[model samples]
Target: MAHTTSHAAPFLSRAGILVLFLAAQMLALTAGAAPYLGPEDEPIRLNANVTVTGSDVRLGDLFSGHPDHEEKVVAAAPAPGQRMVLDTDWLTNLARTYGIEWHPADAYDRAIVYRSGRTVTPSEILAAFKDDLVTKGMPANTGLAPGAPLPTLTVPSEANPPFSVREAFFDPTTKNFSAVAEFTGPEGQSQFLQVRGTGFNTVTVPVLKSDVTRPQVITPDMIVSAEIPDGTLKHDIIVDAENLIGKSPITFLRAGQPVHDTEIARLNLVDVPVLRNDMNREDIIGENNVTWLTVDANTLPPDAVTTAPYLIGKSPRHIVAGGTPIRRGDVIAAQQEIMAVASRDLPLGEAFRSGDVDWVPVGEDSIGAGVIVSEADITGRVTTRPIRAGQPIRAIDVTRPTVIPKDKLVTMIYATPIMTLTVRGKALEDGAAAQTIRVANANSNKMVLAEVVDADTVRVVSQQSAMR
Candidate 1:
């Protein structure tokens, strides 16, 4: 019996030692894989902030604290304000291969917010949470971010759930926003997570794309729509390219500047006549020299001519350039006059008669404005100088018919207010009616100035009067 007991004791002792060694190995493995096997019984330590870089994220990025460095977990990058599961079966298999423990029941799913090409700091995230809380009239603070200490959040038991945002509302008058949230607890589900906070009302509207000076025409390329704070424009302000295109600007504006209803003017259509080429005075304006143009009324002069009659048959005051805008004051009607002109070219010393001249309307400037000769005064008169057809007859251009021939006897009269004396006088030169001539008194043979009143009749004029 002693031998049997001793042998059994050695076998049992060896067996117990082996079992203890196996148990110790199991404990060591569990301890090494403790981090991989998330703590489900304990509160979930949510890392308030998790930063993701590049276009993709991996599980190894979230579990960098693990002792194992061999991990190739990959997943699509999460957008800002998005939640995704970073841990998958492949990660679990990898952990298991490395002798790490993992529980499918553990809450390994994470909510991630990523920023690409933009800065979204931890303070900003915390402030967003605070604002949501403040919006709901709740005073709470969870100042945490990626590098900051992680906060522990004990999710309620299955019978109760944590609060979550469901919907949002905005108040334009106050520029505030409120979020509706839900919280399901064992007692009942409560969705009164009303979060109210200040925010901006964003709007997209067309604005000037560049600086425009006064009198500039608005074009489609001059405006673009951009997002900005709302309530900055009036009700009637122009915000579309169609509404602003082809419109004239009454004032100046800078790039990205807002426009007002009164800042732009509607184009007014007007038709005007324009010269096609440089024209001289009395140049007839025909289709070749003039054209009708339609243009903005504001661009034309106030008195721009609109009719063809205003331009045709009108003489320009000066040389008018081609395409020049026509105005009422730019032209005038040429002066006209009715006067006697030679019917045919008359040579010097040729006798003038009614048959040699004709009355016609000619340009006043074409002939001198001084002397006017009548047909009766010009009948049988001799031309003093050569005259051309249409040339106006002037008193100096021709001589009156001779009433008393040169060296002929004529009766001369010297009349006074109280006495009249008649005497015979000799004509010194040819004379006509109302023509002044030099005569010699036959009674005294003294030369004196006298007027031939009629054939062979002469009236003596005082020497003073004759000198005048």
Candidate 2:
């Protein structure tokens, strides 16, 4: 039994040793199969959003919690100012390829990658093109008109990226140009664009600083200089400051616009007669009552009286206010003559008295020939015909007072050298004192020429005496 027990002990001991060795080997194999943990043992996770500035997108941009191989490039980055989405399948394939310990949570899981950059403005591009053009014999301060609309360009946001023109061609004769513009990116990458346009020389011209109304004088302060394209300048445009200063605008002039030669003119001034003081109708305006005003002829009324001679010795047709410019219809020639006119309607055979006539002043052209101008000539004269009130009395309108009416019985007296005879007669016609008229003898019924003596008396005269 001792011998069997000793032998079994050796076998059992050897078996235990082999078991311990195998268990140790199993632990070594398990440990070798498991993943290694670092100081930061967080799980690898998929990033939902990411932004990149470089041209390449790396594993670090699409996932977190992995730093050892995060910089490994996974894909090309999207263009500047653009975005790309990494879906679950793409993310899974990328992770497997790069050995990243990350997986999408679901099929809908995605990472949106955006590239940050800056847009090159149109003005910046133009300035670059212009600089290149200037170096290529183009005129300085030249204006440009693009042939077609320029395309938008974007570059990585860096500190003042270099923008330049390459392969530029310009024709001084035709004023045409074409060039390729290049923008250097942050990584020394370049973006090229084709540009084509026309060039024009500029000219500095005088422009109005403010709006001016018609007849308003333009002074030096109202003008300003501005640069304009030479092609836009017209032949009649006023370019000199001297041409615009002290000139009046023919019409309204707008600000910041070029003035034309026809738009401005030398001020034309005229001396116009104006009333010095208020005057009523029929009041004479003499030299003392009028004043001359210098006014722009273009702004004056068409019928305005500009001469002082026209206003002097004239009377206002209606009440005129002071400082009012005299017009052709406002005044008439002043009354300069006195003429006899009827104060009231005078019937035929009615004699005019002091109260029946008016001696009024009239213009020289108003009086006619043979018009009685003296009040004495019309006071005691009888009207030969009916005369209206305010009508002038003429020589044919009035005559001496009638001493005997027609068909009236009158005493006819015949007077000779020493003999005087009286007889009853009838007047054949009306007669005034000393006027010759026909009378008929009542007894003989014979007509004889007689001289009117009184209201009821006539003197018969022989044919020889009448003729004398």
The candidate that achieves the highest TM-score relative to the unseen native structure: 2
What would you estimate as the lDDT of candidate 1?
0.63
Show model 1 residue runs off by greater than 4 Å: 1-216, 219-270, 275-279, 283-291, 294-313, 318-322, 334-345, 358-377, 387-395, 402-409, 414-420, 425-430, 437-450, 460-468
User: Clashing pairs in model 2?
Assistant: none
Residue 59, candidate 2: Cα error in Å is: 53
C-alpha lDDT of all candidate models, in order: 0.63, 0.81
lDDT of 2: 0.81
Compute each candidate's TM-score over C-alphas: 0.37, 0.40
Per-residue lDDT, model 2, residue 451, is 88
Whose lDDT is greatest here?
A: 2
Encode model 1's per-residue lDDT on 14-112: one tens digit a residue. 999999999999999887655454434342233334565444554455453443443444455554334454445555564466444443455554435
